[model samples]
Target: MNSRLPATPETLAEQAADWIVRLSADDPGERQQAEAGYRAWKQADPRHAAAAAHLESLLGRLDDIRSRGTQGPARQAIHSARPRRPPPRLATALALAAALLLPGWIALQSAPADILFADLQTGSGEWIARTLADGSQLSLNSNSAVDLEFDAKTRTVDLLRGEILVDVARDSSRPFVVSTAHGNIRALGTRFLVSRQDDATVLSMIESRVEVRIDGQEQAVVVEAGQSLRFGPGSENSLAAIDGEMLETAWQQHQLVVRDRPLAAVLDQLARHRPGLIRYDRSAIAKLHVSAVLPLNDTDRSLQLLANNFPELRIRTLTPYLVIVDHEKNR
Candidate 1:
């Protein structure tokens, strides 16, 4: 059996980093193995390709740094002596931010350096669908993960990161519950979507009903179809009625249907499907609103559509991994 386990994005990124170091070696055998391993990994997951592409871009920048020939004595010593050394965190961070296209991301601080665990995750521009053993279905958006445990008493899935769409199968003996670091969502024979934001979790119901319980809370707030709730670590709960049909189910079809959503918000959503950063002059265009059906499958095309709609909007690409949007005069 292939002992190679399913690669999470973090592990894959590390492997990509290692391969970057190894591929630079002059030894033919090592270079061949590194190349082979990289090809296999890239074939294993679409996300791996994004990781590899990013490493390649970073390597180009390193070459640029070397070509500049402007190194201090200390830096030169480190570079000449440590030929096989891994790239610095700053370089990796820069490359990763570019690869993820973080809009207006300044540096490593904006990178998700702390997130370490994800049982299942998608790449920057990938989506996946899985059928659980119990016949329930789950689909993960790009850059998302979930830890699942199914047993006699419960079928629990911890949304370690990102967003998930769950279609729960009815099993009276085992209650299906989905959780994030912020709170838990008990699915009551429902089809629903759960997204983990920086400081809050957003839950939207598509069918049937579900109960929301914040961590360490007793009273469960029931959310039915056509309803959405945003909760944080504390007991602060904000619930609203929404048309889940357009916003919730549209992603399954690779579409985002929004009504008068701000440009920043739309870019944020679009960033999930792309690798690297999609940065804009937020201060200048934060209030610019858009209403359209943006395609999730081809994000670059979607960006083009957005630009075409707004004559004042200008899109600039520093590298394939870095995109900037701003007014033409600000270019």
Candidate 2:
């Protein structure tokens, strides 16, 4: 039996390192506020304080290495120095903190700035279902984040990343709206889905109707039940009829149903349920088509299934968090 827990960024040690990184900000006001919050967080629990202490010690050792000049004696001394290895926990924390020090590394390793601090977020391969204060049912897909802003006039869900399904409760006075970077979707009926894609927003009408308005566009389009719409800046708007049963199976049973979809598109959806990076050559597998029902919760099994279905495809694990998929011919 493997007793070791996976070293995820959501651990206590990583939270302490996150605070340390926040405190390193150049803004004086931000640093001051962060310091206050850090103090409270450290004092709130003994584990937090211990984690912080471990991270600080790790940083101190790194600072010592940096202090040694890169030329002559310093470089030689650095090569000769044999520092004691930190415990497994401290080593993992240090690795995560070191990545954060690099520019844009946090965004690459975790999520965007807005999504990182979202009110509700799900990590890779994780899903969550919640009932809002207004009794509306909300379900978030893997690697998703959303912020809620409810007021007297409107009940808004700001989707920062990934996809969300909402079963809106009827409120005659207040309208239910789902907002993405590309546009806003107003729920005209009840159940619907809104997804924030790489360069577009997709709306999947499950039960009722939705009014979609793209950014900078005055005219709004109405999407009926069993229909899907894709809109963005450069891309032309596309509306297509969808099977309600397949859509329902996705959210209800955590299954992804596809029919003759491009391998790239299917991989993109699968990547959301997977942690780390999934690297593949776009041109290599451009002609490959996929038609299957994949299990969202078990991404490892799903990858195996893909590998089994496509004998010409090669899937290799470069690391625990990094995967490489390529056509056999590419090699």
Candidate 3:
């Protein structure tokens, strides 16, 4: 049976950071509301309260460090020993800046190095389509990257990260293949979509068929048109039916057509189009369902539509690079 567990420690720490950011807002009304919301969140679970306290203690230590660094003896000793130290107020400002920006900074830095050097790469919120020398069409999703290797024997696409839609040109002599960390998807016919996730590679066959071969596996699984499969190194998911039109809309029309899917799934797609970090409490929004045809190119408008549709959800764009989504109950 499926069951939900308490929020993980990592999630709790993120929530604590969210509270700190919210409570530090400049507007008095916003700060007051954030404080009330934080109190309720802290009271919801002992873990939540402890996490908040621990973060507060860390901030306190930063203040202590700033004080000590600027004191008479330390300041004089440092000045005598070397060049002048930064002003106390400047040091305090820098400390505050680091505390405010560290979470987003860490998240930004977490992107894979392979993406930077990929033969073809798209930035956040950018999408590109290209026709290869073989006359095959390829489209990359936002924040996606791939390295292409074309030779006399084979046409290969190394999907370093994110998703790609390929319309393969018929080449009897050469086979078209998409490779991920877990497996290789060899196109049997015309079109297909391959997405690389943390754990598995998702194959959505659009026009024809594809053969998925997991690493170290002898046999290959055939996915026909209108079918989807998720496979990793060790296991293969049962083939499931997919909406071909929906997959086409994603690449051709640049829109997300959702039907009774989890809110987290929608947010995952939005995160690709959005720059910076999209942070949320998974446990809070896990049960919420979303059904909408949202524009992929305009994520801000899509987010606004979501907010209008779900009053229970509070979506805040904390910074250009940081978005926070949380449930009203948590507040």
Q: Please, what are the lDDT tens digits per residue for candidate 2 over residues 167-278?
A: 9999978999999999999974489888898888988888878888889889999998899888988868878898865788777888888788889988899888976656
- Residue-level lDDT of model 1, residues 201-259, one tens digit each, is 98988889998888767888899999888888653587788888877658768787767
What order do you get sorting by TM-score, best first? 3, 2, 1
lDDT of 3 by residue, 232-311 (tens): 85445778898986778767878877778788878988888876666677788888899889998888889889999999
Off by over 4 Å in 2: 1-105, 108-111
List TM-score per model, in order. 0.64, 0.68, 0.69
How large is the C-alpha RMSD of every model relative to the true structure?
Answer: 13.6, 13.3, 10.6
lDDT at position 125, candidate 2: 83
Scored against the true structure, residue 31 in model 3 reaches a CA lDDT of 65
> lDDT score of model 2?
0.74
Q: What's model 1's TM-score? A: 0.64
- List candidate 1 segments past 4 Å from native: 1-117, 216-218, 233-236, 328-331
The most accurate candidate by TM-score is 3
Residue 5 error, candidate 3, Å: 40
- Report lDDT (Cα) of residue 259, candidate 1: 70
